[model samples]
Target: RKMKGMENLYTLHQEMGNILLSHVLIVRENSKLEKAMTQINDLEVRFKDVQCLDTSHWSNPAPSMIQQLHCQIQLAKIITQGALVRNEFRGAHYKPEFDLNQPKDFDPHEHVDFLEKQHYGEVQENEFPPGHLAYMKRFEECNKRWLNTTIAEYKNHRPEISFEAVNTSLVQPRPRKYD
Candidate 1:
């Protein structure tokens, strides 16, 4: 087998790596997300165009590499779509558009106990840093709306997306503090 599409596969891998680094890293926005999604669509088309050479009775690694490339394309589609839908700055996925400003007088030590507690404990607005109470309210609202597992399935030659509730029975989910 000549392994016809290896060149295309290598190019695709490089392009995809660049796209992910530019669009899905520390800062993301709708435009970047949309561009990434569009690139993934193009990748799908290019992937389908790859002619699979017959490997019956052949002893070579080309077939294995091609299969790995297919899996990589599928994973790229799922991840890009998932990141496109999420509208929050959480963990490693930071979106500048959705980022909230830190409270001017925030004291991490004063609120560490409540922040670590399950269910967030009772809040005393007066005790909070100037803007911290407002920040917590908005954070809670987002947590209620968007805290879940993103589920993607490969069907009909595309990724069908869904969401499932996260299992936080043992330890209630708490917002990650970077500062």
Candidate 2:
């Protein structure tokens, strides 16, 4: 998929990734996540217009890297947007806004439009409204709701993620009192 005017992908990818990386941590109540989402969305728009140097001639990797970068940009948005929707924290996904008591279920379809907007270069009518914003669970809670399969699938070009409880027939869920 070599396209003209794509020469800038390699360099562009590096720069965009660096900028997006800073905002990926910490799940604050609202504004913090809002700010990060804005950053990534802006980058998504800019990335679509990037031009690659056409590797078909020199067989350079710039074209391939550029393509990969484009996909990565969308992925960054997906991750950030997903984090924003889930109010609570589970396992490594923690936001100060929520604790173990508030473990929220992860919704797969929530961030689809954020990913969809990258194509239109503008917020489409069907896109999820902005400012609309997990689950927080203690270690003990993990054995029950979690400890199963975490699923991620792309449906209609959007991520559809769900969880499947682990078959505990062999090992029953229990509280670990390890000191």
Best candidate, TM-score-wise? 1
Give the per-residue lDDT digits (tens) of candidate 2, residues 1-179: 33555336666667666755566665445566678677766766777667766545665776677668767876776676666655554545566654443213323344344334544777444343332121111433444545655565657755565667778666544322212
User: Could you tell me every candidate's TM-score relative to the true structure?
Assistant: 0.79, 0.54
Candidate 2 regions with alpha-carbon error over 4 angstroms: 1-7, 26-30, 54-56, 101-150, 167-179
How much RMSD separates candidate 1 from the native structure? 3.6
lDDT of 1: 0.72
Candidate 1 per-residue C-alpha lDDT over 1-179 given as tens digits, one digit per residue, 9 for 90 to 100: 35555346667768888888888676778788899889977886787656445556668565676788878878888887788888886657767788766565655454455465424666677766578777766666677767788899889977888888877668755556565
